[model samples]
Target: MASYFSRRTIDFLLYEVFDATALTRYPHFEAHDRETFAMSLDSVTHIADTLMYPYYREVDRHAPELRQGRVSVHPKVRDMLRALGEAGLIGANFSFEHGGQQLPELVNACLGYILTAANNSMLYTGLTSGAANLINAFGTPDLQSTYVAKLLAGQWQGTMALTEPQAGSSLSDITSTAEPQPDGTYRIMGQKVFISAGDHDAVDNVVHLLLARIAGAPKGTRGISLFVVPKYRLEPSGELTDNDVTSTGIYHKLGQRGTPAMHLVLGERGDCHGWLVGEPHRGLSYMFQMMNEARIAVGITGAGIASAAYYASLAYAKERPQSRRLNEKNQLDAPQTPIINHPDVRRMLLFQKAVVEGSLSLLLESARLADLAHVAEGEAKENYRLLLELLTPVAKTFPTEQGVRSVSEGLQVLGGYGYTEDFPLEQMYRDIRITPIYEGTTGIQAQDLLGRKVPMGGGKALQLLLAEMTQTAQQARTHEALVPYADKLEAEIERLRTVTGALLPYAQRGDTERFLMDATLYMELFGLVVVAWQWLKQGEVAQQVLSTRPPEGDELAFYESKVHTMKYFFHYEVPKTLALATRLTDPEVLTIASEKQVLM
Candidate 1:
């Protein structure tokens, strides 16, 4: 069987780069040591090996089907969800009070990376975990009592039901209405489209942390409220009954088809009941908790798929012999050389490694911050939270946008076979396309980064991030082999600062559209620089080991490979910043539509 991911790399990032065991020093994570972390990782890996990896293709070949307003997915998904729930993996990152392992976010994220690498098609439990976390955070005792456990146990699925037919990403424009009723429940009425895992038969219930506007409330986002809208509502007598939530239709998606994406209608019979979460008009604030978590998870999914694609192509390149090498063209007696011997293939393979590992490092950095934000006290907590807010969109966008390209490169390494279904790259390419659009589209994430996050708190978040990146560079400067890459990273920080300084004036001048016109490109540039910082950070760790008592054989190759890939990312990938920064700073105003299209 082909290996879908690198467990060794996962260990290096978790234990070496991020220092997962150090998180146990926090009181909240005091119970976890490396042994516990290892046990959890090993258990999840076994579950992934048995349940998810083996059926990656079988689930995709047979997708969920909607019949008579009910959706049924592949039978294996039922087993996978049960195994995840039984193993207590669904709520791995939750607190002990919530019946979770109370594992550090750093460790929890690695588990997700492993599972997603095995089979991204079975992305069901993550939604449930996010939804349960919402109720745990904001819901009343009764709401939590009713929903949290079952959802976490994977008996009932959970989803973020934010998108509506009218308001796709515009949360303020959502038309779903919730009318205050006498029994402390709201009567929900409207349609929600593109709800992932919205309706599926693998679980007994699907609980939606839905966003809707209450009657006579303020307009736009301030009027929004969150509710626990379940498909089967529990009655006073403890019997489950239909809650007037209809599965209007199921979307046959381009990928991630194992879980049903549904078009749902509530209160079709004027009987849909929803219990309010938190206070009125503050729904958007509460939902951001889950939304941000899902954003990072989507980033993991992107990296995971890219990792799988990289290995698939890497294995193929090692075994598949083609024409003789360019230098060995005259050596007919040399026979055919492994495609890996070719320089171009090597370049592509190096690129896939750079993106996959670099992206994982970036995500783990965010996960570490998340753990800190959750456990640290006073100023430390607020600072970690703010830094997380700044990196969320970038974290969500970079792996996903670049992962699509990285998977495409992996496909290229396999030549014609990559396009055919005989290989997994084609499916990986299709699967990763949806990630950039998962939490938010690339353009939206860019606007979030350059427009809001960059300037928020008078630019404190960006300042903190730069300080962090600079610290990594300074540490790497001590290692002679990593000095050059460290220097380039330091220079890139200044370029980022200069670029930000140049762009803020448009926003200060009140030209919002003009300020965000090239936001997507800005996102691309920002992702590349941040990922370069991540590469250097990894190189710093690998360099310290190699310079000090590095082992022989595969162990030596592993550390050396880390340094080599860091150089590849800097030399081959970092130069593009010149073009990006140039275009970003240029005064040309081209993309904004102003009733002056010459072609039209």
Candidate 2:
């Protein structure tokens, strides 16, 4: 059997299911058509499969070598990245004049899924470059022209620096400072820890978008400002010049060793030139522009990893022979069947399939919201923005947490072979473990959901999201087969409402940490219900289409499969929301109050 992403599934989602073709009706996407979109995706998939996927095992084996304060990735990996950059994939969504295809976020995300799925580390060089380009949009023209081309061309790479040893999650505690220089630029002096791709030698230069406090600025997050700090400065004519930024060392990782994580010292030589992006004291606002975008990317990364692990395990299970049923009625003896034939193995594979694919749907839906919000006009546009904001936390958290589960189950399916480096499952497991820890921990995302996101616009965001879910439920009610599922979801919505009412006041009363201690569980609860609703909506649409005009051949099978998967998620997975709701209000959870005494 061929191991490739299902192109038929992509077409169904792109053309039939989401009616993504309707995007052409919008002004922002007016210049693009389905053919161009399809071509771009196909090119990216080929590049990812051919160039990126092959390196996965080797990179892990020969992890970047750190020598004398400099880290060196495999030369071949660098060459492959250069080729990918030359293919215009590094800046897939940038405007045309910058040597990009000006693709919509939807198309760009679809393209990203392929590369990320093929090899996540290989995509980091481009991912950070694209992020820096977004910051460039708000930067000066000189800054834009100087940095954008190098980044987009993959001649240079980009990184976002915000973390410090003491200020891992507390931005207000960040002590890095930027002092205004007489020459209009600021001199940034700070040590950033755990900076991803902070100092990869693959590119000509590395541009860092750093967050630092200005001298004499107010205390806390409000005093912070964002800076475009390149590792090497640009000359008067737009060429490289030496800057004070240098990496001190690289952090040895548990997995994804192909991508270097470095600890960097900025302005060690007494002058590191940096251009301030946006307004001073407004860094968080601007950084969120990148952070929110990266959140969605993280979700995609999680989904991609899970997808890879799931398929790999599926192939392994179908071929690797194992012990037969306990009560077999074989007369002489039946040859041991493939593990996939066993009920337990099947259960594991199904769990991975559901979580991985469910996570994919959630991540892609968030990307679609990004597209709709950017292109649509009037009320639809605002509604999309509201929906996007409401789900961004879920987009980041659910997939990552579930991704870990999927990978673990994948490894378990391989049993003992999974524990050795000889197999890829262990590496996948290690690589994905960090997803929930970094890029805003799962706890942080949950707090954001309960504290900031849900209550934004006086709770209008949550209201809009609930309304959309309600509309889907009402629509699904028309189908007799879906009514029960819809009714269960409706009941979950009511539970979510009751829990939200209890938690909100506790958060407001300055027991925010206690409120958020349970926030992560609540986040999963909300996500399960919300994702079930999405699946239900998709199922309803598939049902209606199948009833009125049955799909032919594989198309019919695909639609039917979607319907069954949706049912699986609803009936088996969504009911867990009830347990979560109970856990949210459980008094026993507060036993953590004594955890400090235990530590003492």
lDDT of 1 by residue, 19-108 (tens): 888988889999989999998989988988898888888888999898898899988888889999998999998888987989988999
* Candidate 1: segments with Cα more than 4 A from true spot: none
Q: Indicate which candidate wins on lDDT.
A: 1
Clashing pairs in 2: none
**What lDDT tens digits, residue by residue, belong to model 2 across residues 1-600?**
235255665666666656677877876677789998888887877777777788887877787766876678867667766776788877877767666777777677777667667777664654565455666667878778777877777688888789998889899999888999888899889889988888767877888889999999889999999899988898889678878888888888897788888898888888888889878989888888888888888887887888788888899999898777656636337878889988888878877877776776677778788888887789988989988998999989988998899899999999999888887789899888888976799988988898888878888888888887888889899988889888987888888888888788776788776777788888999889877877886788789888889989987987887788888887678878889888887766553566454644
User: In model 2, how many backbone clashes occur?
Assistant: 0
Instruction: List lDDT for all candidates, in order.
Output: 0.91, 0.80
Q: Model 2 residue 413 lDDT?
A: 97
Cα displacement (Å) at residue 59, model 2:
0.8
> How close to the true structure is residue 198 of candidate 2, measured as C-alpha lDDT?
83
